[model samples]
Target: MGTWNEGAFDNDDASDFIDDLAEAPDWRTVIQMLDHVTKSAGYLEAPEGQMAVAAAAIVAAAVGDVAILPDDRRDLKAALGAPPQGAVALARSALARVVAPASELDELWQEGDDHDAWLTQIAALQTTLSASQ
Candidate 1:
């Protein structure tokens, strides 16, 4: 099983660190990590609340980079636009939903079964997303 950054989803300090990374213009590492988390979330099975929670966790880590800004920040928008299609887009969308400041990741996590379906979905999404790139 892949190890998750449990602290990132459960604590403020870890979230702050992730937030700082997301804010950096050169966020390659952050992006890659988010990508990984996206794949992980996709694997979550339906009715499995943790899927959303995992997605939310990943999104929270990179929301600063993906969030839409006012017209003044066109450059930021262009740089962080959604992925074209397939798993990449799906992953991006899932992450976007989770990190949306108003989202409740803990709630989602608390609502689902711990099945391997999520892992499968994430693996497929990861393969498709990576191949597309």
Candidate 2:
């Protein structure tokens, strides 16, 4: 039998590292993608369960991305053309949920720390509304 070395697959060359980093979606991109999905009629009509999963993934990714950024790097107040209260609160809430160290999927799901799941669900609804235009 061949020797099994777990670290063999873990070596990341520059290109590989870049590619991996590229695959890590940005919060803005995740939000945009979810917006697109929600706008699609097929997505809107998708079963509630499917929609929920997609929404959760988007929110989780967005929260995770934002959480890693320093306060100085975040400019949502200007970019969003709105006061920062809502966005800040939303980000804070989502970050709390996304950063939990729960090891099990169910535990993560049940934690509901930041209400990221709820925010995602709301986003999906907003997407549906926008798509109807």
Best by TM-score: 1
lDDT (0 to 1) per candidate: 0.38, 0.32
Model 1 agreement with the true structure over 1-133: per-residue lDDT tens digits: 1214332223343344344434763434334544554445343332222343333333322233333222333353345344323434545455444443333443343344632443443344344434445
Q: Hey, what RMSD does candidate 2 come out at?
A: 13.4
Tally clashing residue pairs in candidate 2.
0
Instruction: Give each model a TM-score.
Output: 0.28, 0.23
Residue pairs that clash (backbone atoms under 3 angstroms), model 1: 42-122, 43-118, 43-119, 43-121, 43-122, 44-118, 45-118, 49-112
lDDT, model 2, position 115: 39
RMSD of each: 11.5, 13.4
Pairs that collide, model 2 = none
- lDDT of candidate 2 over 65-89, digit per residue (tens): 3332224423432232332223333
The residue ranges of model 2 lying beyond 4 angstroms of the native Cα positions read 1-25, 43-55, 61-133
